[model samples]
Target chain A: MSVKNLEELNPIQIDVLREIGNIGSGNAATSLSGMLSNTIDIGVPVVKTLEYEEVVDFLGGPENVVIGLLIRLSGDIKGMMMYILQSSFANVVLNTFYGKQLDDILNVDEMDKSAISEIGNIMAGSYVNAIAGLTGLTIDISPPSFCVDMVGAILSVPAIEFAQVGDRVIFIDDNFKISNDEIKSNMILIPEMESLSLLFNKLGVEI
Target chain B: MSKVINVGIADLNVALAPDILATYALGSCVGICLFDKTKSIGGLAHIMLPLSTEAANPSENKRRYADTGIAELLALMKSKGANIQAVVAKIAGGAQMFATNSSVFNIGERNVNAVKKVLESYKIPIIAEQTGENYGRTVFFDSSTGLMQVKSASKNIIVV
Candidate 1:
């Protein structure tokens, strides 16, 4: 069977998808709180079904230099999960991990890089587990890779894959909020179109 | 201000001298720019996949694939009175934004290789290239001088 575009999903189906995204982000927020040893809250998850080009603008613009971490998932369901912290918030995360003031510049060292990788791994791991638990599907994630790049470049990871079928893509926008700090982080999940259907079917959401 | 033309993903366009052709946030996609020095006309394509045959079904946007997009770019330039034989290529983007252990996410490398192969087949010499790194680049092609300005946060403006 051919894949269905995100536009084809009904409003009810979209709500169901948004709830799933909420659960995933809830799990990820827990992990972040534990990692930083401080309370972290997540804002309402924004779910959008957009074309590839619009997705590029979701993180402000294609040229916004942001710190991004990516993980590819397989097994019962396949997709790509990403964690993004703008350079400003990334410094806050680093300072929290290091327990000291880092330079004003965003200079991430080896340890800092690994911390970012860990962030990706933990967030994606929890998100996939949330889906797996909800739908009773087995899921496996690949090793995490971290890089500092423009939002456009990071998003292109999933964009290239989805392009094979069509221009449509499912975007799960999760915003991270840390207590007492002006910090912002974004977690975007792009699920494969086929796997998305399987998820919706298992959850009994009418499409 | 020089007029700048925007190129979309899987879409190709051409412009004349003193006009700039630009594409944004090229991560895995290759921006292929071909310019005729004498006529001062150039074209650019933001290609996603490496080959059309690799797609399960034929994509409606032929410019989405490397092989077809390059050919279309040449054809577009030719229609505008640009000499195809005199056109030289300068390219940017084709970066592995993330390091995935699995080969499925290695589309960036495949895209770079496919773009090079396509150019080679067309007998177009590549004058300069900035590809296969872990950074996203926005490239602007100046048809006036055939110089491509590659901009990224991590580096200086790469001119080719």
Candidate 2:
């Protein structure tokens, strides 16, 4: 059965999407808080259909954007999640952890790798788990591998089938307020549209 | 009095007196700095990709890739009256950056391998190197002293 188009998705379906985002993001925030020993506050995650160009703009004036893509089997659905973070934002997060004022606008290599990797691990694991629960599926995430320097180059890779149908994209606006510094991270979830329908059927949601 | 030159990613600068060469911000990219202690001459090349053969335009863009870069760097040093055999090398950068399930895309690992092989072909020993993992790096070489300093996630400064 062909899934209803985005325009045809009812209010309940929209609410379902928003609630799923909230649950997934909440799990991520909780995990990060436990790891850092610092109370982390997260805004309610929002779901919307956006054009590719709009998504780029929402991410800010993209200069050196890094996108991390992971595909996992969750129950009956094959979930494809994309995590995007601006290089500047990554530096801000690092500086917050250092608790030092950045005097130079230089390279970010000065920060420790363990710290950054831990951040990626926690955030991706928690967010994926939340999505799995909402869809009533079990998912095993691949270790987070990253590409840096150019967003355009990463996105151009043919291996990542991001444009495929049955893809539901959820963009997350993550803000970390620590030591009076605000750090932002973006998370995007793109579920294969066909798999999504199968997932909804498993959830007993009336199409 | 000798000169030194320091190079950064995508950009190169020269220091003539007590010549020193350096490069920073190498991830899955290689940094090759050549030092001629006797002539007090040095040169640094910070390359991003692996081969210039894949470039849309291939006309000796040293900052774009590694293979073509090493050749260009060697020629540049030779032009400066620095003998290739007398130059000692220190290399840094080429970090994993991201953890992936497949080792095939580990550009950091690839970069280190390519650099070592090229330098070996030239019979230049890598006197010092700091690479691998998911962090960034900053490298400084003082031509006057023939000293290379590497700073990264770790606090200790690696001097070569």
Could you report the DockQ of all the candidates, in the order they appear? 0.76, 0.07
Could you give candidate 2's per-residue lDDT for residues A76-115 as a string of tens digits?
5565555665655456556557754434323335244445
Interface quality of candidate 1 as DockQ = 0.76
- Candidate 1 error regions (>4 Å): A1-3, A100-106, B101-105
Residue-level lDDT tens digits of model 1 in B1-160: 6799999877889999889999988999999999999999989999989988777886788988899999888988999999988989998889988766677668988998999999999899998999987788999999999999999877888887
The top-ranked prediction according to DockQ is: 1
Q: How far is B41's C-alpha from truth in model 1 (Å)? A: 0.5
Docking class for candidate 2: incorrect
TM-score of chain A of each: 0.88, 0.77
For residues A1-207, write the lDDT of model 1, one tens digit per residue.
423776677888778767777888889888889989888877887876777677667677888777777777899898777677777676777878876555632467778888777877887887788889899999999777777877887778777876654566656676676777755556666777788888888887764
Once model 1 is optimally superposed onto the true structure by TM-score, how far is the C-alpha of residue B95 displaced, in angstroms?
Answer: 2.2
Alpha-carbon TM-score of each model against the true structure: 0.91, 0.50
